[model samples]
Target: MIISSPAKQLNSKLSSQEQEARQNGYLFAQLVRLYHTFDGRPGNEYSKLQDAIACVLDKIDQNDHPYAYTNKLVMFIEARHALRGLYLSPDQNKLLIDLRENTKRTNLNYVYLSAIDATSQFK
Candidate 1:
């Protein structure tokens, strides 16, 4: 879905941190939209958190923009927590837990992969 967000228009004048926040804010908004729109069992929602992250990441990638790992990680953590009450398999839960733990480090690339891997296994 195309989101009509001003954040999509990155201003070069914005500092690195500002750009990162703008991107993170945009991604967070999308995540919230997904949660509210498809908030139920995996079968009912047809909207896996993994896909949501993927979509957000894809947008960032396509734009070839520099982003802050911390901002992205926080957004992911918030999304995961937002869906905490949803029905999830043990593996999925473990993956999220691990992702949360691993994200503490400076590198956060693995969290993306882990999120994708976890959802593929179960919702």
Candidate 2:
């Protein structure tokens, strides 16, 4: 869960945008780790599941970061797509979809999300 080093030690000179990218990269890495490690379970109380939820939420929240909204949406879509293989509970899946849909409504850009989907085949 401790994804960052001390800001003074590592990012003392980074611009706000650089710091934001660093944070987003950490959350994206967490999502990828969760995708690899989550047990194929339908339980909501699993720690990894909770971690995945947190990472997803954080990624979506980054939409409001100073960086472009489209870039953040792509990141969110990529992270969400990475979790697709996990055997999450129905409620968990609904929560994720709802989060993405809520972000979509506010960001109002399906093309960005679709772009992630379109490029996923290469991965």
Q: State each model's C-alpha RMSD to the native.
A: 14.6, 12.2
Highest lDDT: which candidate?
1
Backbone-clash count (model 2): 0
Which residue window of length 10 is worst by lDDT in model 1?
114-123
1-123 per-residue lDDT for model 1 (tens digits) = 876556645544366758666755654554344445445544523455546555545545554332433235345545555666455455555444544453343444543545522443121
In order, the Cα lDDT scores of the candidates are 0.47, 0.45
In every candidate, how many clashes are there? 0, 0
List pairs with backbone clashes in candidate 2. none
Best by TM-score: 1
Query: Which lDDT value does model 2 have at 111?
Result: 31
Assess the local accuracy of residue 105 in candidate 2 as a C-alpha lDDT between 0 and 100.
Answer: 32
The lDDT, on a scale of 0 to 1, for candidate 1 is 0.47
